[model samples]
Target: MRAAKGAKGFKIIGTDGLPGPAGGIEAVAKGGWAGTFTYPTGAKEAIEMSKKILLDCATSVEPTVTVGTTAITAENAKQLMGK
Candidate 1:
């Protein structure tokens, strides 16, 4: 916020639209950002694959996994934030 103070036409686009006081949601809600995005870490997928490899003794799993993401802007930020 301090960096953009008194600066004209400055915009902030953040990542990890997480919850909490200091997260991207709050930043956007407070007008400190134009928008933000959430990046899935694929931890759940990794765990599931591990289970298949260990329990099922799978020979191989999918070579790649695609995670999903969400875009948070003023239009939906408030709704996503449950505000």
Candidate 2:
């Protein structure tokens, strides 16, 4: 209700796409936030790298890996919940 409490003209955007009640996606779905982006962990990439190094005997792997993020807005906020 911050928007109704004089914050009207200000768009509420969240950086973390936390799910569930009172989370970022919920806030956006309920019209409390304008938008948000998902914060993903690199666990999948880590597991792949470990297998490559241990099983394939790779000498080296890329030190940095880029993980993609998903944008959450009113249009797709609800669909992302319980996911």
Candidate 3:
């Protein structure tokens, strides 16, 4: 596995790079957090509304969306994801 520059001890080789004879390793993108959800319906709508709320709030106060590469890291992993 190849590690990304400035990632410290983290190795993010990803799915594209496995040994020639991949030992039963199937790399697939697992569906993760896509924002809040509601039973029956309105999951996407809820997320949109939440974004709007966040945008409105950010107009007055600084706001951060912890998405993409910025969200996942070794330091905050345990705290955000738990044990």
Candidate 4:
């Protein structure tokens, strides 16, 4: 867990919400759009943000493929599954 391993905070570059429930498998809190930033206040803002980001960067073409290239290391893997 980066947070537990002395990471104050981190940035995720080039990310998009996952296609299903598996998206939140590693989240610390529950709410908002899957894999999108959820403000403690609500999910609307996060959903809007996701929509804008998706619209601007990627097209929603059916049969689209998401190349799963996210890297995982021993140091970070635990953080994902939780303590």
Candidate 5:
């Protein structure tokens, strides 16, 4: 995920790509809300590039966490939510 402080508030983005499905989420941290988008295949590169842009925006505001498959499990989600 990536996060940045926007003119209105902070923004966060999350992305993932799987064999037959791909999706991403863009979030505004100020109100703890988000929106999502999905694409079947051809837009993979664009999705990835958008993620990079979000990360770049975040770099100026806060640290970012980028992890592979193993770290995004239900157990981890629970742990993070607990904090």
Candidate 6:
């Protein structure tokens, strides 16, 4: 993979099959807060692009686990507070 100039951060490498002569390596390195994707020569760019696409779908707030008929909303909060 081509390394960017004066950059430093973590890298995430992914591959479909075995890492041998038959199957090659696919790597992606992302810098801190910059949010960029890179790939090696002749390698399919879809994998790298998919990372950004998938990350775009990510949410800062995690999903809440609800059970039974428990109500968790502004109205519920108000009722629970006896307001």
Q: RMSD in angstroms, candidate 2? A: 2.5
Candidate 6 overall lDDT versus native: 0.31
Whichever of 3 and 6 has more lDDT, that candidate is: 3
Q: Rank the candidates by lDDT, best first.
A: 2, 1, 4, 5, 3, 6
**Cα lDDT for residue 24, candidate 6:** 21
Error of 4 at 5 (Å): 26
Best prediction by TM-score: 1
* Candidate 3 colliding pairs, count: 0
Worst 10 residues of 3 by lDDT: 28-37
Candidate 2 lDDT over residue span 1-83, tens digit each:
55464755778888869998978999899888899999889899999999999999999999989999999999999999878
lDDT of 5 by residue, 18-79 (tens): 22212222122222334322223535555665676686554443244333232223223322
Q: Tell me each candidate's TM-score.
A: 0.83, 0.79, 0.21, 0.20, 0.19, 0.18
What is the lDDT, from 0 to 100, of the residue 71 in candidate 4?
38
Candidate 4 stretches with Cα past 4 Å from truth are 1-64, 67-69
Local distance difference test, each candidate:
0.85, 0.88, 0.32, 0.38, 0.35, 0.31
Q: Give the TM-score of candidate 3.
A: 0.21
Write candidate 3's Cα lDDT for 8-75 as tens digits: 54334232221122311122112111111112244566576577667665444325433222233333
Determine which window of 10 residues in candidate 6 has minimal summed lDDT. Answer: 24-33
Model 5 bad stretches (over 4 Å): 1-4, 9-23, 26-33, 42-83
lDDT accuracy of residue 71 in candidate 5: 27
Highest lDDT against the true fold, candidate: 2
Score residue 20 of candidate 2 by CA lDDT: 89
Candidate 5, residue 8: how far the Cα is off, in Å? 0.3
Query: What is the Å distance of residue 19 in model 5 from its true position?
Result: 11
Q: Per-residue alpha-carbon lDDT of model 4 for 24-81, expressed as tens digits?
A: 3233223221233211333555566567668766454334333334333323433554
Off-target runs (Cα >4 Å) in candidate 6 are 4-6, 22-83
Candidate 3, residue 37: how far the Cα is off, in Å: 18
